[model samples]
Target: MKESEKHISHFDIVVIGGGASGMMAAGTAAARGKRVCIVEKNNELGKKLKITGGGRCNITNATYDIHALLSMYGKAHKFLYTPFSLFGVNDTFRFFEERGLPLVVEAGNRAFPHTHNAHDVFRVLEKYCIDNGVVVMLDAPVERMVMCRTKARIDAIETSKGSITARAYIFATGGASHPETGSTGDAFHWLKDMGHTVTPPSPNIVPLRTAESWVHTLSGVSVDSMKITFLVDGVKKFHKTGKILFTHFGLSGPLILNSAHTIADMLHEGVVTASVDVVPHLAHGDLDKHIQEIFSEHKNKNFKNVAEYIAPHGMAVSLMMMPGMPLSDTKVHSITKEERKHIVHTLKDMRCTITGLMGMDKAVVSDGGVPLGDIDLKTMRSRLVDNLYITGDLLHINRPSGGYSLQLCWTTGWIAGSCAE
Candidate 1:
């Protein structure tokens, strides 16, 4: 038969969305003697996965304790106990290592393939699927479903090419983010139509925008150690300390992306702002003393030079331009005590008002999906649809950007594959 004329029918299991979780699930099921097939809308698998962490693919964290790993999932931590315990971080290491793809743990306990190529990670999984006898159909977008008489279960799925039937179906279609990678949230609408309560999808772990011109001036400046406080109407809501990268629009990096949620929420009521402490480890008094010493050491030098030594040159320049700030050209020896205090304040409390969040195209991971109650956390099977399993970003588990998202994909995909009859 011609490739387009091929109609795969009556498989033991059928998996949708050939991304990380979908590929993992299909490969896992086929490994255990199940006749499995993966239906991917895109021509290639793992498009988004290939680009994660800029193509390095942080597979999981070195945090081996199940509790610690689960904690990264936040409120959904409890829901993941079963899947994670089944195939947690260590097991992930073993899974990849056994496949001859070793992982290395970098700073922050993030584990990436030793090759540091995300395509390498996907290559292994793709080979696993191919070697295990799993059928892969690319460009087969699921159009709609064929539900059973009860209207409470999915009997089969009708795709763009043809209809597929299976004893079990795994929907690992990911989420709405990165639609360019083919995760356009087809399952969300499909699941919601089937009575599942899907939480509204929003861009998560995305960069923030700012109205402050100073932020734009410091566009490529990055502070290795800094604290960011999210405030609404000048009242602090929350804060975190980490590295931050100033962008033309606003902020990016671990410090800003993780806090974007609080900023998103605070946008409703007041002016959302971010107050950055470039030297969070240093106290006000200590910083002043330190600045005083630096000024004395470079008494005749331009303040700009000293400021650049204290912080990034761009930030120093921007700080000097802030309202009522002394000129960057001022000599350090001529700096007044009040001017010293102003410098300290600017160093400790660089402020920017958030304008908005970047759109879904830039989201590292989306914040919403099918709520947990709709599926059994123990098995990743639908409570409403008995023969159906869901995994990955399809679940409404919000987590910070790290290896946590991919780990969730690994665990849930493996479990869904293992448990699917």
Candidate 2:
């Protein structure tokens, strides 16, 4: 028998795209004694999962209150009540813990494996599918979805390997974020062809590319705590306080990534700029006194030499390079009170202009897929196609980082797997 006939021709359920939701759906269906198969394009499953949260795998947001948890999903929060009801945050905790993968909640109520390794998260999901006897088909990319001749039902999927037929189908192929991980939004096109409205995808949870060359110099520096204020054409719009990592390309870390979409909207208004307050906790008077003391202590030294004593580590040089700021080479003893005040202001309001959001290639999550109205949220089934279910990023839901995306996957996948016939 060829690769096409390697497994049984028919399965109780066929799940496409073996990432977080696909694996969860397949395992859940198999646990119900249904024959399930997950067709993955990549040779290994969980390609995206292994790299989430910078390889730590933020498993889920541990916000157990259903209403509060759903609110993180933005406008789609209302549509998620049914699916989340089936498998809420507490159920996620119980499911993984029952499977021997104890999760620990960190700051921001984000949950992770005890080992803090994404591979460990993948291991648990992979084992869940294996223990439930779900068939795993690797390197089998589905080319298209075939429909039954007389009805609006998915009959079978034509894959690179062969044809796969199932009574019920689940499309968890994900959105166009991190294409290298194999989630290239292939299912969106198929869903559109099948008569489902697919919202065009855009990178929502991604980093901001900046117009400043100085930001590039401070590449790997991460400020543990700082206040960043967003300004549109010099008018202050909003501000956030958190950790931020400066990248060669731009700004990242949880704070910047979560703020990218909002900044993207601000870009449409006018010139977007951000002011980074290096010492947010300290008042200007206190900071000036502290800096004056530092200057007094190093009176004989050049300002550049003692710059690190003032600003956050690795940020002093870049902060000094800000336009209209004092010269770094000036002797501390000779520096005027006004120049010192300028240094304090520059440190407190370090500026960088926002260019735009990073492309889908660097996106943590992309929004845009089948709208919630097209699906029966309670069953995770397509209202248009009776036997087809949707899960994960394939649904257009805008959510910030900090494990909310993975939580959506787990909730929808479990519900679809359990309810699909």
Give the per-residue lDDT digits (tens) of candidate 1, residues 222-285.
Answer: 8788888888898888888888888888889987888777678899989888888888888999
**Local distance difference test, per candidate?**
0.87, 0.91
lDDT of 2: 0.91
C-alpha displacement of 320 in model 1, angstroms? 1.8
The pairs that clash in candidate 2 are none
Q: Clash number for model 1? A: 0
Write one digit per residue (lDDT tens) for candidate 2, span 141-250: 99977799999999888888778899999999999999999999999888988899988899988989998988889999999999999999999999999999999998
Best of the candidates, TM-score: 2
Single out the weakest 10-residue window by summed lDDT for candidate 2. Answer: 1-10
Model 1 earns a TM-score of: 0.93
Off by over 4 Å in 1: 1-8, 300-302, 331-333
Superposition TM-score, candidate 2 onto the true structure:
0.96
lDDT of candidate 2 at residue 256, scale 0 to 100? 92
